[model samples]
Target: MDHWDEVRMFLAVAEGGTVRAAAEALKVNHATIIRGVGRLEEKLNTKLFEKLATGYRLTDAGSDIVELAGQMATASSQIEARIFGRDQDVSGPLRFTLPISFATDLLMPTLTAFRANYPDIALEILSSGSVVNLGNREADVALRVVVGGASPPENLYGTELCEFHMGFYIARDLACSRSLTPAWLLGANEAVPTDWAPDAGIKMASVPIRFAEMRSQLEAVRAGMGISALPCFLGDADPLLARVPGGPVTHIGDIWLLTHGDTRRTKRVRLLCDDIRSAMQGFAGRLAGRFEGGASEFL
Candidate 1:
């Protein structure tokens, strides 16, 4: 009880069911976990875990502290949220979580400009497909593409940046082939149907190939592997690719610049949100799928 850090480690191991699992979750060495838990056990004078063939099992004493430890964790997060929300300074670490594809393909310019304009703000990007829990202070802000422009979760607040339009794109040269049978290239993480880049209900194509990531899928399309659906901003910018001749546009969703209500009042967070909204304005045409082929209206 005297060592909060040790109790925290014990809670992690208990929740994760193994020392190694807890270590990975906490981003620490398993040996460090062992040491922490061991110290905690000595401090409390009781054994907390019993290792079985399956995994670690909490002993009576460990079970007793689970609820208390969980409460402690929640209280810690609440304190962090309140303090961070009250911070008015324009300079500090600002963690933003967003989709990997957006980060790699469309966000560099906006992020770079934000950094340049706010040199004191430490920008951190957690670019992945997974959503970071803002309520837990895992990230200060999140950029998400949701099904509709309206109705965000109760805890979040933001403006809808733009509607993200997706289009079936094929290599410019390949689309011109008279006898060509286009195959589908899709993201492996997509549902088995991969309807986002569907065959448009008319097909005479070869089997599809799946890539683990969007960049790989984009590269495959660029290499003329087959047709794929991409955000207009990405596909339209590539000179080698074009929307499939007369293909119908797909509305992926509206991009929302969301921050938990707790952090919305923070100066840096609000400033970054404003910058992103302004940047999105410039690319409104591209996001709406109004590509001019070789022209530069989005510039």
Candidate 2:
């Protein structure tokens, strides 16, 4: 097999941690990925990954090779962008990674408008909280919400879109009752706050449901399951929900639009960046949660 094809398979397995996932990404069968990895390992005379019950775990050799492979991928992407993507008429598929909540709640409507404005550009949206590797071409651009002090990778160029605040919210009907300790509906892996104890006059009942996705959390809040900290844009806009009184902003994060430094200047990338900036400006007030009392100060 050619070195490029073998190396591509190896890198996919390393990143995906499973042959099945690599197959899906490459649009090939699982056996093909498995064979490719085996052949590559035989050629190198080294065990690339350690098979485990959970999934494939990379060995030291695999990790070392993956870094080199990633560099190669980045270089290839840069060359392609420079050579074939220079046309002023932008037309191609662009992949963007972002948190699911941001995509579904705030960005989806604007993206439809973007498509209307630029009919030639096709969008592929990848939603995840885990950071995507733009350098590896996993995504061309990213919309990230990071904590106030967190820094993005140096290789990324970013435009700050807005700052957003999170606060406790509950169903509007449940807003009037301070006597009852509402059942908590938590985000996935989230622990109920210890401060929500009887001593604090905010004790919670048993939490029966928790969701990893923000949309599910919002639905639970609207159903009066319990109070949760929601982004002000989502909470304020929902007619069925209301901000829980007396809770200050629970979290603050800045939303950033980011692209790899190498691709930032590509014509298509540049055009999309400008489009996103303009769309974000239209939502600046809502993105910053300006509708909530005193929330504008945080923005």
Candidate 3:
């Protein structure tokens, strides 16, 4: 039995939750995954997984080996990088993760400039909201927004990049033509606590829309669908949108830039981090929502 290949297949199946997903991630056919797992179980003389209608569930024996397999994968990657990774030119794959909104609204617009600056660095962006573990090399760096002033994981080393100020925003014409009411638009998955909205001075009216994403919410607000709380950097920059007067900072969060201790000083990683820091610095005022009145410099 080829232990390496067998363990690789097992790891993929365990991580992916289904043979089909494992096959897709590994770029192999479904049959290959099934056969590989079967051979692995045969070698161990134990049923590693229980086949069920929804998906394969790992048995006790399989569950116990997952951590070991993950360790092997990490070690193997490290060895390969140490031996053949071209460290001279700041050239390699750098996996970066951030919230979907940051990627879409902020980074996407300036990615071309980053690409032009660091042509050798292969940038892989993970936009899922799930936090990937930097300790395990799941990602090289992350830009995360956390509310209520919680600290990031102790294992990671980074700093708060900027204050993410939020404000109630509506279309310029909507504010000019009508009185603000409780027709608040919300992200489909967002939960506006029953008491929180009213406590924050937002009076609820009949809502016309529940959008699935922040970008959609922004568009709906632009089209005069409803008012929504949006990041100052996004809402303030748009000429067509205006902040609701007397609406205090709806939410205040900090944008954290983090990286594992292992890669913090890597040339490429450092360069990318610097670029992000500089970009945020340039928009510090807008991001912090600093203003004398309703829409002074922000508007």
Location of the lowest summed lDDT over 10 successive residues in candidate 1 = 192-201
Model 3, C-alpha of 137: deviation from truth (Å): 1.9
Tell me the TM-score of each prediction against the true structure.
0.63, 0.64, 0.62
Ranking by TM-score: 2, 1, 3
Instruction: Give the C-alpha lDDT of model 3.
Output: 0.76
Q: How do the residues 63-88 of candidate 2 rate in per-residue lDDT, one tens digit apiece? A: 87889988877886687767755555
Worst 10 residues of 3 by lDDT: 290-299
Candidate 2: 10-residue stretch with minimal lDDT: 290-299
What is the Å distance of residue 40 in model 1 from its true position? 44
lDDT of 3 at 81: 73
Candidate whose lDDT is highest: 1
Candidate 2, overall lDDT? 0.74
Off by over 4 Å in 3: 1-88, 179-182, 188-204, 291-299
lDDT of 2 at 89: 62
In model 2, the clashing pairs are none
